[model samples]
Target: MGVLSNLKPTESELEILQILWEKGDCTVRDVHEILGKNKDAGYTTTLKLMQIMHEKGLVTRDTSSKTHIYKALINQQKTEQQLVTKMIDNVFNGSAARLVMQALGNHTASKEEIDSIKKYLDELGNK
Candidate 1:
């Protein structure tokens, strides 16, 4: 378990959180603008979700002005690591090979991505 354990966002909340993660610090309007692209997300919806996310400690709010800006409190990499570890444990039956294969099967990787994976494996072998 990590610092954000037992604290995960719903799909809608994850959408807002993803915006904040990308923007670093943004107003509710900024988040709304991004999420509104794919769906019908009202400004107030983004605003309310951010307030709830702040309460959940998933985001840090700067209350310097009337429009408080929000940013993610946790590092993306750490969260991904924890989530992947949990997936490997539960869904993969504790097999890293099965997990990696399942993930790779789902996407078309670029040449750069393939090279990066090979390089990473080479480094791991060195250790």
Candidate 2:
């Protein structure tokens, strides 16, 4: 029971949301410019996608000014956690351990990262 239940942003929407999350409230042109630097995307395309996201409740905009500034309505951490949970359930048969093992095996963890994971696990065990 979280704010973002059943709300999955499409890959394109996620890209825009990521920009909003990182840059904070932004106009369509601001988003479009930043996104364009990465790949081939049109201003109208970014604008339409942002408008659709607003309709989906994924973002909110302040329209008092001529140039509207949009902000993500969903919490980034919660959304990411939900996505990972779904992936674990569907792709890993609900085995968190398998997911962790696979991630660790696939990506080499630095010493600091390993230590951080160990510390986090210890805290979880204590809880």
Candidate 3:
């Protein structure tokens, strides 16, 4: 776990983190280019956000070379779990079942996804 394992990244910071998580270590320009595809984000803004993320211990910067490379320090699965747990507790009144039902109710699950859910439930029942 990272020092800031409990840290909840701001939406912009989360966007940068998603890039780092998917692409591994990246230069600020690399992230900025990808973000530009979705929104009008300046290069310096991405750099500043990445710098702030480094200060927050959410990512590490390798500065041995001229161009700095950044990588996510927090595990993606752990961060997802933390956020989901918080959402379940606060938004769903701590009811995982309600959360599941709400998600399934709103979103269309594919046959394969429904089969996977059933398999998971079967495994839980067996345990």
Candidate 4:
């Protein structure tokens, strides 16, 4: 698969993607207002990015009305899985165990969450 075959997003594009993922589908104005809270993004920037994203096949555009509505074309879970695999390959030499171990060592988990994780590990062991 191409690096972005599953779904690749450039750094600047992620903010808009996040909005789509969060809001389901929205107009450029809606995405701009939400992003404007965190950054100096303008309405036209949102408009241009949506157009570019539509061209990239990252999103679908509906021109059924005066205002265009944008929606993500890819599944969020699948995209995240691809991104995690790519990150593990690049930063952890593709050793998922090492990546999990590092993250486990670096972050603290609640006891309940730890128990859940152990249960999941047990389930995987059975498989």
lDDT of each residue in 1-127, candidate 3, tens digit only? 3433467798899898899999999999999999999999889899999999999889999999999999999888888787778789999999999999999999999999999999999999999
- Residue 51 of model 4 has an lDDT of 91
Query: 9-108, model 2: which lDDT tens digit per residue?
Result: 8999889989988999999999999999999998888989999999999999999999999999998888889889988999999999999999999999
- Give each model a TM-score: 0.89, 0.89, 0.90, 0.82
Model 2's number of clashes is 0
Q: Which stretches of candidate 3 lie over 4 Å from their true place?
A: 1-6
**On a 0 to 1 TM-score scale, where does candidate 2 land against the true structure?**
0.89
Model 3: per-residue Cα lDDT at residue 46 = 94
In order of lDDT, best first, we have: 2, 3, 4, 1
lDDT of 1 by residue, 1-127 (tens): 8875677667787777677777788988888888888999678777788888888888898998998788888777787777778879989999999988887899998999989999998999999
lDDT of 4: 0.85
True-vs-predicted CA distance for residue 58, candidate 2, Å: 0.4
lDDT score of model 2?
A: 0.91
User: Candidate 4 at 70: error in angstroms?
Assistant: 0.5
Q: Rate the local accuracy (lDDT) of all candidates.
A: 0.82, 0.91, 0.90, 0.85
- Residue ranges of candidate 4 with Cα displaced over 4 Å: 105-115
Ranking by TM-score: 3, 1, 2, 4
lDDT by residue for model 4 over 1-127, one digit each (tens)? 4536645788778778878998999998888899899989778887888899888988899999998889988777777788889889899998999988998899998999899999999999999
Q: Give the Å shift of residue 48 in candidate 3.
A: 0.8
Candidate achieving the largest TM-score = 3
